[model samples]
Target: MTAETLTVVDTGRDKKREQGQAELVAAAVEAARPGLDKIPDPVEPDGDGDLTAEEKERLDTCIGGVELLSTAFWIAGKSLDTMAKGHLIRRIPHKLEPERYYETIEEWAWLEYGIKRSRCAQLRAAWALGEVLAARGYHAPEGQVRELVPLKRKYGLNAGVAMYEIAVEQHGADKVTAQRLRDLVKLLPEDLALKDNDDADQIARMFGGVLEHAEPKALSAGGAIPTDVRRGVDRRALDLANVLNRRRIPRTEVERHLLEAFADEEDTTVFDAVLARMKENKGK
Candidate 1:
């Protein structure tokens, strides 16, 4: 009331701040609204989707009521680390777990926005790719999103996105359709299919011509990876890393209790060596 009664003047700073806030909110909404289908069945939310104290404040204030849910978004820092966690932190209010407030995303979306579950899924997917689609004026959106779903399912989300970018580069955006994207992902070597985010990124840049091809002596050295090439060392490292991302077997369980996690005793020595090397690398 006091602010309304008083006239305020700005020296452009206010406008810039407001614009920044608006952009953050828009990006947050997109990140948070991942497809309903993407949610796990048992729904193992990251760290059980625990809301930080800051997140709790936003739920109460930003989404003050059902009326605000559709239009409002909470601010979360948009870093690469945070991006992977976009769906995890943003949508906890909708999971149907008792401790988590016993609401389903389907019902929650319906109650807040009057949108169907399927429509929510599509909107979630589209918004997720907003940046990518924005480049082409979002031409042929339906066809684009349609293919993205399958690509995401086959290779994890990051890999799918890499493939999409590669597809756009190889085949112009105007011609890049659902079928075209499908054929591109299929063409990826089997060894490359399950790539982690970094590997996917390098491949995307290499294929998309963003990465300069370094070939003075051998022109073709900068291009194409064939199916038969062995990825023995790198692939094994990635597989091991993925396993380690989950629960690591306790040393006490393996050494003291003599668990069969490793069939051979020599493998235990190898694990110790790998851990030492990892620690050494981290320091550097």
Candidate 2:
């Protein structure tokens, strides 16, 4: 075919795909409504029971959420009620005839909404973090929202929000980014994944001491922290090895010798406490 004909053919294919996708979206919403309406009266983890008034209210929320999603995926980007959407999307399955509708939200997301489970999850996290940040008066864009997601996942949504506030307060939201957030989260004690402690100031203070010893360059973004904890543990282990070398002790013998010395004690709690104290006082 001529180049002009080829271009027209490709354009036709694009139009066809677009039409099909639009139909798919409409169909998904159409399909979900009946199932949502039929939601067996109750929508708990197990679907055999009936729904309470409170449960019915929540079920409406889920149904309303899908409607909102159909019209405005960008509802996720909006500050108003964005988290409610995220929370619902994260739990769209809602035990609504699991065996009939589909076993998991991921399956429903794929077959019904035509959205990948990964994108579904990302929207859920990003919306949650974004709303939390918005509550703190920062309508963080997707970039910053994306950064805060890891913080939310690692700690809690409050922790993520707290971290965003800290970052914006430190560097202004425009200047801050995913990389900047990652840097901040990394400096947080390697073990700073506290779910219950969402206090921003308290969390901000967590890595404060690490700064005293960490070089300025050390704070520069290393791009990203590995999602796998083992990678971090491995790096920390290597650093510990270097620290051990400074003390001129063999790695294996240190623990072995400690056991030998503490052989008389059935419980090593006393030694563990001492070692913990020594770690706490390392700089001093």
Candidate 3:
């Protein structure tokens, strides 16, 4: 296939569809919000049993932002009216709390093998973060604009953490950066993955792992396989030795001694290729 064709194939149509849904949901919520204070019955009702294939189907018509807001508004026990509340309760699990809502949503969406409510929930989270950031006098970084456009094309307005991570990378992290992130997260819709500061910190630690492994110097340092892959390689080496051994090399000790072979080029080819060449009069 030509390059152009390949690009088209690689394009994430699912993400684009998600983003489009978010835009629509955003419009609906905005319209709904202004009338909220005037409405008497603000709580949407809950769906008691399993959603039918049709109700499950309508859930797809909703996007991430809508699900999130619906979750929040539902949990808050506020809806535009009894009619609206009935509509929501009939549509989604009314019994489940916002935190547990994703589980049910994921199941239904996955069952259909089409656009899922879980994706919309993620997008809504991203959108809330953006809203919080904008409220704090921030904007997407200049270079990130191009990248975000594609992500937005794929993921929608809800690509919050990733978008912020890019911004932080480009702009540099400090008190302001951290503050903005914390602030934005505070505005997340109900049923967001984060429960507390620890949750946020866990995510940060995960990102730290990414950065630590992403260093160019580390990548270029022989482009060695990762620790897990190294374990597999070492196992292979021991199996090779079991073949060579008058007494086979012990498989149990393979992980420990693989490092030793790595140190010398001569022993290295089988176990430590780097160490194997260091040996004198060795031919393989």
Q: Which candidate gets the maximum lDDT versus the true structure?
A: 2
- For residues 40-133, what per-residue lDDT tens digits would candidate 2 score against the true structure? 4543463558876767777786776554442343353342234334444454443455544344555655676577867767766577566555
The list of candidate 2 runs beyond 4 A from truth reads 1-99, 193-195, 208-284
Q: What is candidate 3's lDDT per residue for 47-159, written digit by digit as tens?
A: 67887675555455444334345335322222223323244333454343544333343343444334356453443334344444444445533222323333334334444
lDDT of 1 at 93: 53
Cα lDDT, model 2, residue 27: 90
TM-scores for candidates 1 onward, in order? 0.34, 0.42, 0.24
Error of 1 at 116 (Å): 2.7
10 residues in a row with least lDDT, candidate 1: 213-222
**lDDT assessment of candidate 3:** 0.44
Using alpha carbons, what is the TM-score of model 1?
0.34
Candidate 3 or 2, higher TM-score: 2
